[model samples]
Target: MFCNKMLELQRVYRQASLLALITIYYNLLEGAVSVWFGAGDETISLFGFGIDSFVEVISGVGIWHMVRRLGRGETADRDPFERQALRITGGAFYLLTAGLIATASASLFQGHQPQTTRWGIVISLISIVSMQALIHFKTKVGTALNSPAILADAACTRTCLRLSVVLLAASLGFQLTGIGSLDAVGSLIIAVLSFWEGREAFEKARGLGCGCSCGCTTSTKSDH
Candidate 1:
């Protein structure tokens, strides 16, 4: 049983590492594409895709921090304060999501169609799948490990999965209905969802002793 558990941890760690590396590379590629297609084409979807890539990059960085903490045998020693900080960061990430959605909506209203390059839809699909996998793994780790940072990471991936739904809508609406407004409306919906997630993250962080003295400087058990 002990061996099995150890193997599971090793597997999870490997998966996390793969995700971190890929997300960073993906962000660079996406940002370049978005910038190149910024004008005279998809002013919103392309730009929004770039923004989403950055968000993933942030998540990758956060995960890297947590991974190092785990390596140093410090995860177990993390305090409530650190946990609250993670929550705050999570809240900020979602708030940025709201801003991205707003920008996407505004662009759509201005009738901006993404140039539909070879990479846009394909990469988006791959990202959607990757995020879903991350969400599942992170949520499980957070619950078992009692790690707020892990939980927040899971939540961000969940948000990404939800936003991908809107992207799918944009694809379909463009192909079927030919109504550009559908894409705009989808962006609005995603923005509203982002706001809700942001508020949720803030509340969760507060519950973990944010803006209060909970003496979060010490942990007896392992955070991993």
Candidate 2:
């Protein structure tokens, strides 16, 4: 029974690690594609969304490290490496927020429109489906392991899901209505959410909860 239990736990840990890696790689691909098309098409929202994915890669690294430690049965406390990664991720998110806000405001002021939002429509749909699947699996694995860090990571993915929805709506709205400001409007919304994410990252670095509904904060407290 003991050996079987250990084997089962090992399997869960491997799944968690694989999920983390998938997230990192997927973000890299998504970020590259999004930035390339966003820049070519001059779509602020898609551009900003791409930047967000890059930042997420940094955070995913920390999660990957944590999963490795947990697999070894190490203490679940926030390690220095994870803390530093969170700090860097937080700063990157803040910078992204500022840049997006500035560009979006300018675009709004000038009534600038993208050449076409067709790519945004396609990319956002893909992101929406991908993020949803990631969230479900991450949450499931986190539950199996009872790991707050993993659960919080799942919650963070929810932000990506929301961003995808915003992009999709703005892209579709513009395609249907020929409104130039919808894309900028979507960028502004993404900026706001990015700011919130930045704050959450900092909070996590400081040993506080991410303030998401995932109950990670409560779980962290209980662990102590």
Q: TM-score of each candidate? A: 0.62, 0.94
Alpha carbon lDDT at 83, candidate 1: 49
Q: What Cα-based lDDT does every candidate model obtain?
A: 0.55, 0.86
Clashing pairs in 2: none
Could you say which candidate leads in TM-score? 2
Per-residue lDDT of model 2, residues 160-202, tens digit only:
8998999999989899998989999999998988888888888
lDDT of 1 by residue, 7-118 (tens): 7776666555555565567666765765466333553544565555555454455455555566444643334554455465566557667776767657666775545433
Residue 113, model 1: Cα distance from true site in angstroms: 5.6
* Residue runs of model 1 more than 4 Å from their true location after superposition: 1-15, 38-40, 76-120, 132-152, 200-224
Top candidate, metric lDDT: 2
The clash count of every prediction, one per candidate, is 5, 0
